[model samples]
Target chain A: MVSTVTTSLADVASSNAALRAFLHGLPGVDRVGADQRAAMLGTRSIKTTAKAQAIDLAISMVDLTTLEGADTPGKVRAMSTKAMHPGEGAPRVAAVCVYPDLVHVAVETLKGSGVKVASVSTAFPSGRSSLEVKVSDTALAVAAGADEIDMVIDRGAFLSGDYLKVYEEIVAVKAACGDAHLKVILETGELATYDNVRRASWLAMIAGGDFIKTSTGKVQPAATLPVTLIMLEAVRDFRATTGTQIGVKPAGGIRTTKDAIKMLVLVNETVGDDWLSPDWFRLGASTLLNDLLMQRQKLTTGRYAGPDYFTLD
Target chain B: MTRLSVRKTYKLYIGGAFPRSESGRSYVVASSKGEFVANAARASRKDARDAVSAARKAFAGWSGATPYNRGQILYRVAEMLEGRRAQFAEEIGGGKKAAAEQVDAAVDRLVWYAGWSDKIASVHGSANPVAGPYFNLSTPEPSGVVAVVAPSDPFLGLISVIAPVIVTGNTCVVVCSSPMAAITFGEVLATSDLPGGVVNLLTGFQKELVPGLAAHMDVNGLDLTGVDDPELALKAEQDAAENLKRVIRPVAEDWTAEPGLERMTRFLETKTVWHPVGI
Candidate 1:
């Protein structure tokens, strides 16, 4: 994936000051334009045959997530089972995201199904732990057979203008994740601005994250369209400059098939077809899968499906 | 300077909100003399789908409500209807006295059903004499969401069909033939203590809406009283079998007559409970 321009961007990581200069020198986001563009792209009405395809694509791109403190092994197993077979002939979800402790349960349940197990680590939802603890947390999930590690960024450090602290933590966690893919959760709700989301997206990609995620699903306003749009642009720009493509996962607030389709629209319009696959884009939601399944049933059966028919998570 | 008259557009009531039909279509609702009265929102099958969803969402809360509480809310709806008598009579478009009588009958019919909220269960339920060391009791339970087709009798027919469904703790999605009065009845329901989605009124043709509701798996019951067409009613009843929905057959009715316990019991399921004696 390395391009000739890789060395020029890699030099910025040599120092904290260089990284800050590059992140800050990137053009500031016009908040209004980003909002307007996201809203405009959202208005595209995908209907009939196109809608059916989009529903299946969105289902495949779902990282069926359960990040609650009360998530148990049984719950994880059930969720994993649902993730692998949402409905008859429906595409399996891209991954199943759980708290770090339940990684093995999901891994065991999803064996031979090809659905990746993603564990949120780094004292997830709030990256307030020491780097030693965070690295071990990633290592624990990796050892438990998690294929992906979703580590939260140090919001306290990032908010305090310590970009290097956040960058180094992501790097340490990435190193701990052996062969597993790394998804850096920005917790954009805490970041407070679009430019910061863009900067955090770049920082995670530069720090060797395989995917740049919007949130840990524990925060409010976890993933908004505009924030995701900004992240998509950052990934697009990163691939252009460094020739390395980073996946985008917008976790949390997306709870409906319509919201899932809107996220797809944002991806399709923002970075075009290259980022539309499950490998590049994922919706980190728990309830979104059932809605997609219901919609898929509606499309195939020509009637609306009830929540009663689908098993509750 | 003269002020512009604000025209009242008839809209659908779903989940307690007055929304224009998603289809963005309206039909000319005319008086008995065939003159156009107003344009009523012509709800499509999608609207039926939305109304069923709303009714389903409201089912848990409405059905869980105490029978006495439901009675109070139904009584409150009757009170609201009483106050709106003149508006409903004018909307129904008959002689003032006759229209007013129809509105009064609807109000009285609602009150009658409201009184049955706490008593209907007792009337329909029974204690079985089982030859075991246990007490076996059979009581009626609200059968989830109901989809109803209201008769063309603008006020009395609609109210008679709806009040019984809701008073029994069942939420309903209703397709009413008289658009103006149905939407206006929505206003009365909104002003009452009754919850928004407890009774969703869709102003559209029954032929267009019944099939969708019948096919809706979430809807537990269907009242086909308003569907005058035998073919449409048969098709809906057949489709309702997809989920084994309890269906009430179409029947001509005199709204002013005393209503039997049948309307209240039609959409109710008999839940039998067996308990050890003295436990």
Candidate 2:
């Protein structure tokens, strides 16, 4: 396989033709190999002290998301409070993710609490809106004091081999984010192939996204191990040539402590300690926090904790 | 050349699937005459934890099901067991006549419990006579996941303990000594309409398995009816007290005798609600 890690990030996005060539020219993902490696990594025990520490770290790395259409202001406030103080003596989550309209509630609730507020934009889960609308949607969230903007890429454009459109959209949304961090959601379930996931990861990073996320938690086959593995490989390779570190957030379907620990194992094995912190690696999920808290309680108290004690997401 | 006989491996049943112990350990089982019967999976604490997790996962769907629907499923389990009678009879292994009789009794016992599903509510629940302008009523709801320690009678005792717990919608993790018979019963339940995790059967040393379950904060009830050792039962009761678990003490009762409503009622919580009367 030829090395497709471009030395220069600027020239690749210069034109649609150049962006397409750069993406297509990137090496293909060995589908079977990635699946096998992820499965193997998942078998890691991570026992006792290591497990306790990983649970806390995974809890802190959670985005504490609730992106439903029925999300009320009260819901967002409750989620924000839960994110701040997950449980007694437990570390707070990294951020509270909601739709762009509710960013103010999350931001206001999370103020001075050090828990960042992330808002999903660009027509969210579908990304079917116009570029003007997408940019303004992102701007609205940023204006509402969102610390981060999670923007979805147009899969229709990307799958039709219009890599340039996807790349440019990320760039546009990144520009709209201002001082806030921009996380580009590939919605990898719709991406269809590991090869596309790799190319999309590079596209998001090159276009100045602070993090490349997996799914919107609205899609099935979301945030799988093999997909996250491919994205982690992309961010690792991107950081190698450019010396610019990008984050990876595997959202959705990661609802258990075991699944969360497996993600941490993948990060530790693939990218080492540099990306271990919440600023670098994150888990975007709603139901996952309670499981993490439950596991944490088990580690400390030596008895299995039930879902009854924890607040429902 | 004559074909070699394929012997079945007796495994633990958790979440409706036959999985070997997580510890990768198995123990030898002997017949009444002390002859080698089979190798049974010796479950560990992790396995117990997994069973509780599975039981907890199945709780909502099983509990929320309509009483009539649950009745049909329980009846379906009996139908499945009836077809597998000979196999269960052979595994029960006292004598041909005794084994057959026990399996029949088990089937009848199940059918007996199945009949109680829809009717139990009306009989146990009450319309309270309050001295005010309101309608007050009390009904029994399944008290979440319960852990069972099965008695040594194998087939009938296993059926009696499990049938009552599940018929009312409470899910369970059972520690039984008779591996072969329990696993066969597990197969019957799996193919039946009853959901997996509703009855997770673990065959192992009760000493190792009982304490963990008794102390589990997730398990809502503990049935120590099968514990013959007084000391072990006492320790489990103490651990159970940590979580305020509702427990049933052991009794030297005959399995063939008529079972009362107490077995089902013991693991149930009375939900009393008051609704305003019609204007």
Candidate 3:
């Protein structure tokens, strides 16, 4: 019996080492820097129509941001009101992302529209609050009619090699979300490394994040390809681990069709055909729509639609 | 020797006393010999709520203690468990070897987490590079009043789940395994000199008790690591959303599988402070 236990322990240790080696050797694309720029330039001329349609599909699927910092309740209400009906031909953005306290206004305004009201909770931009307050914030958001909650993980904990703490907090936040989808924001800029990003992504999924997001859009150096690549790999691994499909949202600084297609490619390559649909993928951007529309007109008419083809409401 | 059938009744361990299930309902727990032991109490939603209240009330002093002091107290629990190893071994049906290892691992894990009280912040924290020079340092903190579903399995698994939550200064209301192990462990908790509500144990069907705790608006977090069923874990996650409770989905490993420090830190929150650097 003693020998059996010893051998089992040894086997577990060796197998873990092999698995680590295998992960370390896997080819990872960095979608954040020069590599992403090259990829974007390479695909810039792929006949704007197909690309426009894809970008439109991605944008329509996304939940864009409208409120942040200390915007007044009235301004938030107005933003939601305008967001609901942006005139006749305007392609509607998916949803409005806001602070927890303002979730109800957006939810109330967007009622009957399929658009969701997502709230950034658990200390958005910087997750430097107590778990009690964070959980309360999340619960309060859900109660206030937040269709989704975007939570920031304790990057401090993750950096310290405390994967379990990061994982546990994501789980707790997911629980607090109830029916509302929980988007675990990695705040990739703070994560610093692709390896950390990959691990953080898996940790979030296992801990119950419905969607693993790229950034809160508040931080600098947001949304790069390498980071997105690592996250996409994480989503794929999570699917393999639990046989469940999780969503991915890359927010902050995504402003053009070129940017949108690269993310789509990363998702397509990493998770394959199943995740290409809107249900599994979303972009959180306020400016990517018009660029897509401009490119779409160029594709059909074979002439530049110029800068005025799209209007910002 | 004549065979004697000993009727086992599952009971509730509250405030250092083992009492009949307040609900007046008793369920039979079978021993390895296939004979029934004492009937244990099946705790109700009220009981879970009451447990949370007790734990919340106790949090101030428990979390306020110096890490070294908490470490010593946890070490004391280990000593108590070691002294009572024979009782656990016999009750849980594990022989001396399994029981000894379980007790040692639980004790070691407690010590490991106790040492982390003062040190975790330093190890898991840093100062960020902001656009402006500001005095900023991030430190890990405790998420309060956690409601944990103790591993449904006896002995080792139960200890694995409960120790990590408490070591981090978060008080817990634990629904322990349904069988005889909860009672035995409850005895250890009673004598461990742990504060009255610091570690509350409930022995009953986890499915019935978990929803109450998960949906409890006051409970800060839910660790559902013990619910093996994916459906139950999913339901617990959904229920936790009502109050936006922190939900920890079940990991595939056994309680003793990972180093307990990881679990301890997971229940912690990091507080980072930034002050402008314009001197």
Candidate 4:
């Protein structure tokens, strides 16, 4: 959590040019090595004593998310309440993620619970809108008392080699976020390569993203082990170079306790123990919470609870 | 070089693919006369858990399949079994006459069950003569994933217990004792049109796998036909109660005898529906 280099909005262009040089000049990743490392870490046998602790840690690091056009005030409220108390003996989730329109409902429901409300903005899932509108989206969510703003990077610009444009948009959104923490979503599925993922990780970090995220949970191949592994290496190297550690969130397709535990293992080995907490690592999933709760109950009490026993919120 | 014999490695079948036991353990198998057969994968509790997961995943598509399609798939399994008759007969390891008879019975049993798939519902379902002005009906539905311990009669007994459970659209994980016969049978299932996970066969000790399968929350039923030890069978029954799994206790019976509706009905859950006459 040390500060090394600061890239301000006034210096975004020159900083982006220099940042591009740094990120591109960064050593190219060998895909086979990254996958092999992830596979080996996945095989690490987390036994009874450690499994119980790992399940709870995974629970606390979850950002219980529901982002859909069908979202409603009641749905947001119920999910937020579930976020506060997942089950008996279960700890509160790190945050409740919702669309900008329902941020107020989540904010009100999570009041006094110490669970932050995260709103997804900037034309989310698809950042095809103008900068003015995207900034306003962040502004509205922040004004509505969102403690965190999850923004989507302009992949179109990034893919077209307009790294500076993507960097400046993030800078503008960061300015709009004001006091709220900013999470930049790379939607690595669309980025198409491990190299692009590494470059996007650096772009977000240099532009002041508090956390570099893997997906928006709306595309196929959203989050994968190899992709997340490459991102963890990016954040780990970023901290070593800049002296500041940024968080990593892998959203989508992670639905079981085993999947969550493997992610924790990846973070533990790749970035070391410092990134294992909710402050540094997160799983953007909803169904995964119930699995963790079920596993936790199994560890505490020697019986498995049926789906009917847990609330479906 | 004198003829190089390609000795086969016997393994467990889960999710339609052959894989070694997750525990990397294997046990030696031999004939009743103590003749060396082969080293078969001795599946562990972890393997049982994996098979249960595979069965659960395959349940929806399997149970949702049309009865006609299921029947066709079961019939296709019989056709494949017929083609591999010599292999099964040799694996069962008796004199030619007895082995051929056992293989024939197994194939015929599959065909019989295949025909029953489309007819069992019609024979079991009833429209009640209720006292009120309402339409009340009861129909049988597949009871989700089932766990089976294949019977002692390696070939015919294995077919008898498995056919009835899956014929009703239920997916199952079977723990067979006879490694040679079970693996050979697994080859037939793989070649058959039956879906990959519809009938997972694990070659290992029933004592090792039965407890894990019985206790698995995802498994909805238990068919302990292969478990001969009364004490072990009782323990599995107790473990199954954790999830209130439908229990099918093992019984002493001749595999070649006429099978009853009891095996079919035991694994079916009768769902009753009521509707007003006006509607």
True C-alpha contacts between chains kept, each model in order: 0.78, 0.67, 0.00, 0.11
Model 2 earns a TM-score of 0.95
* Residue-level lDDT tens digits of model 4 in A1-313: 2133334323435855765665576577788898898898888888798998999899999999999888889999899999999989888999999999899999899999989999999999899999999999999999999999999999999998889899889999999999999999999999988889998998898889999999999998987899999999989977876688999999998999999999999998889999989998989998999889988987777554555567786
Distance from true position, residue A122, model 3, in Å?
0.7
What's the distance in Å from true for residue A59, model 1? Answer: 1.2
Model 4, runs deviating above 4 Å: A1-16, A303-313
Ranking by lDDT: 2, 1, 4, 3
**TM-score (C-alpha) between model 1 and the true structure:** 0.97
Tens digit of lDDT per residue, candidate 1, span B1-279?
A: 999989899999999999999999999987678987899999998888888888888888999999999999989988998988888888888788999998888889988888999998778999999999999999999998999999987578898899889988899999999888899989999999788788999998877888888888788999999999999999999999999999999999887889898888888999999999987
Which candidate comes out best when scored by TM-score?
Answer: 1
Per-residue lDDT of model 4, residues B74-189, tens digit only: 99999999998888888898788899999999999999999998899889989999999999999999999899998867589999999999999999999998878888888889
The list of candidate 3 runs beyond 4 A from truth reads A1-44, A81-91, A296-313, B1-279
Q: What is the DockQ of candidate 3?
A: 0.00
Worst 10 residues of 2 chain A by lDDT: A1-10
Across residues A149-265, which tens digit of lDDT does each residue of candidate 3 receive? 999999998787665566667768888889999989999899877766776676676567889999988887788776676677677765664577899888888887778887777
User: How accurate locally is residue B43 in candidate 3, as Cα lDDT from 0 to 100?
Assistant: 81
Of candidates 2 and 1, the better by lDDT: 2
Expressed as tens digits, the lDDT of each residue in B138-209 for candidate 2 is: 999999999999997757999999999999999999999888999888889999988999999999999999
